[model samples]
Target: MGQIQLQNIRVYAHHGCLKEETSIGSDYRVDLKVDAQLAKAAKSDDLADTVDYVHLNHIVKEEMATPSKLLEHVGQRIIQRIFKELSIVERVEVRVAKINPPIGGDVEAVAVVLSSSLPNFGNQ
Candidate 1:
């Protein structure tokens, strides 16, 4: 198995509990990690054999375009989409961060992390 990491993807999106946040949006960052079997790609040196980072980026962007009430929901949707779209991916971890949240205090960012793995329901 091998891991692929896509870190610090910056996006301006409308995702928050507050009405102002959804209306104006905020700068956000996303980090994703995917675990998959990569022996074939390593040997063949072909993009088809591996999960393409560009495609992964597209997925993140598409999901981020949709507004959500919470960071947790946004992260969960991204992870679920990745697992559904990328058949080779066995597990995924996603982190969504809102930069300079509206907490009425000095804060750099607030983030939510979520992870999921495909379950072998039939095998068990």
Candidate 2:
């Protein structure tokens, strides 16, 4: 198995429990890590033999565009979509971070991490 990681994907999104937070929006960051069989692609030099990172990135961007109440929800959607769309992805880990969150204190960001494996994510 091999891993592919996409880090620090920046986006502006409306995702928060507060009405003001959702309407005003904030800068967000998304990270994705996936495990797959890459030996075939490495040897054959064919994109079809491995996970397409471009597709994975698209998943993140699309998911981020949709407003959710919590980061966990956003992360979950990213993990689910990757598994559903990529047959070769054996595992996935996603992190959704809201920069300078409105927590009434000096905080850099708040993030939620969610992960899943093929067996654990069977049919959903």
Candidate 3:
């Protein structure tokens, strides 16, 4: 399987545990790694045979635009959306980073990362 890496994808999103964060919004950086068999696309050189990462990025951005209570939920939503929207994907790894978090203590970023595979692995 070939891998598609979409790293350090920045988005302005409203997602956090605190109410102020939700209303004010913050900078969110996402790194998505998608694993899939690209043999057909590689051989045929057809765009349809592979996942269109540009479209995938737009999907993730759309989900991030809406405010959510938890980053975990947002991350899961992103994962689910990828699986639901794209058929060529076999596995996905998502990392959501809240840049300049609202926590009391000083910090550069706080992030949540999640990885998941298709339910029917044997089919892959």
Candidate 4:
């Protein structure tokens, strides 16, 4: 088992419990860790042998473009999408952050991290 990571993926999205946030939107960052078997890809050096990061990025963008109320929901949606679309992926870790949260305080960011592991089914 090996990992492929997409880090610091920045996007502007509408996601919050507050009405203003949902309407106006804000900057968000996402980090994704995908666990998959890399032996075939490594041996064959074929793009089709593993998950395509470009395609995943597009999927993430599509999901992020739609407004949501919670980071947890957004993160889960990403995880589910990866798991459903990429059979090679056995586990997913999604971290989403709101940069400069609207809370009236001095804080760097607020974020939610979620992870889900799927059955390998002897593929690895």
- Using lDDT as the measure, which candidate wins? 2
| CA deviation > 4 Å runs, candidate 1 | 120-124
lDDT of the candidates, in the order given: 0.90, 0.92, 0.89, 0.88
Q: Across residues 43-95, which tens digit of lDDT does each residue of candidate 1 receive?
A: 99999999999989999999999999988888877887887788999988899
List runs of model 2 lying over 4 Å from the truth. none
Winner by TM-score: 2
Count of clashing pairs, candidate 2: 0
Residue 121 miss distance in model 4 (angstroms): 13
Cα shift from native, residue 100, model 2 (Å): 0.2
* Model 4, global lDDT: 0.88
For residues 57-101, write the lDDT of model 4, one tens digit per residue. Answer: 877887888788889989888888888899899998989999999
Which segments of model 4 are wrong by more than 4 Å? Answer: 120-124
lDDT over C-alpha atoms for residue 27 of model 3: 97
RMSD of each: 2.5, 1.2, 2.8, 3.5
Worst 10 residues of 1 by lDDT: 115-124
Model 1 superposed RMSD (Cα): 2.5
Model 3: lDDT equals: 0.89
Q: Give every collision pair in model 3.
A: none
For residues 47-123, write the lDDT of model 3, one tens digit per residue.
99998999779978998998998999888888888888888899998999999898888899999998889875334
